[model samples]
Target: MTQLIFINLPVADLDRSIAFYEAVGATKNPMFSDETAACMVVSDVIHVMLLTHDKWRSFTDRAIPDAQVSAQMLLCLSREDKAAVDATVAQAAGAGGLPDPNSPQDYGFMYGRSYADPDGHIWEVMWMDPTAVAAGPEAFAAHDLTPA
Candidate 1:
């Protein structure tokens, strides 16, 4: 069976978070959404469940860390190409997210950028040359592969 990932995040404003995610290309899955939580579909196998603080408390007793001030983990997603990575970050900025909390990384074969949502959840978007990946490093030394 195929596995799907549901990233559960505690959000301060359900509506704002929904709008922010939507602006970055995720579609709201109303089937799993209510006032307390919303399921944002990022892809066929990727979903983000945004839960209100009160709703989050029901699942865990630990205090919800202030995402703006501290980070527990950094979430990342892949894109089709370099341009797609930039576009996602731009959309996020337009939606009130902080663009590039981290510096852009360009390894020629791989490119990555980041953005933080209004609630301060950092997400990295990356792209890698498929040909280079498939061919591997040895192929590059053999002059058989080059990143575009």
Candidate 2:
């Protein structure tokens, strides 16, 4: 079987997170979802497991951070162009998330924006040019260095 990746995140309310992800275009995956988790498929092989904090604790001993004031990770999505990035950010905002205070960045080959989910988890929506990226690693590195 081909490899797949699942990103498991602790959520205060599984149903709410599920609703938010669905609003942002993710589809529910019943195979890994239940009362404790709402699995949302982000791609053919990339799934997000929105587990309740209690259920999440069953899988680890670590404490879940208070997402209202802290961030544990940043999930990023790639887009086809700058407009796509803006649209994604807008969609996320409309679904209850808030746009990040940071300004957008435009490298020669890429552009991006960021937003924070209702729980304060950050996600970046970006657009990159494959042809420009293929030109050289320097371009990619240069793009990454630009302030966002």
User: In terms of lDDT, which candidate is strongest?
Assistant: 1
For candidate 1, write residues 39-113 as lDDT tens digits: 999999999999999999999999999999999999999999999999999999999999999888887777899
RMSD of 1: 4.0
Each candidate's lDDT (Cα)?
0.93, 0.82
Instruction: Identify the runs in model 1 with alpha carbons over 4 angstroms from their true place.
Output: 137-148
lDDT for model 2: 0.82
Candidate 1 residue pairs that clash: none
Q: What is the lDDT of residue 80 in candidate 2?
A: 80
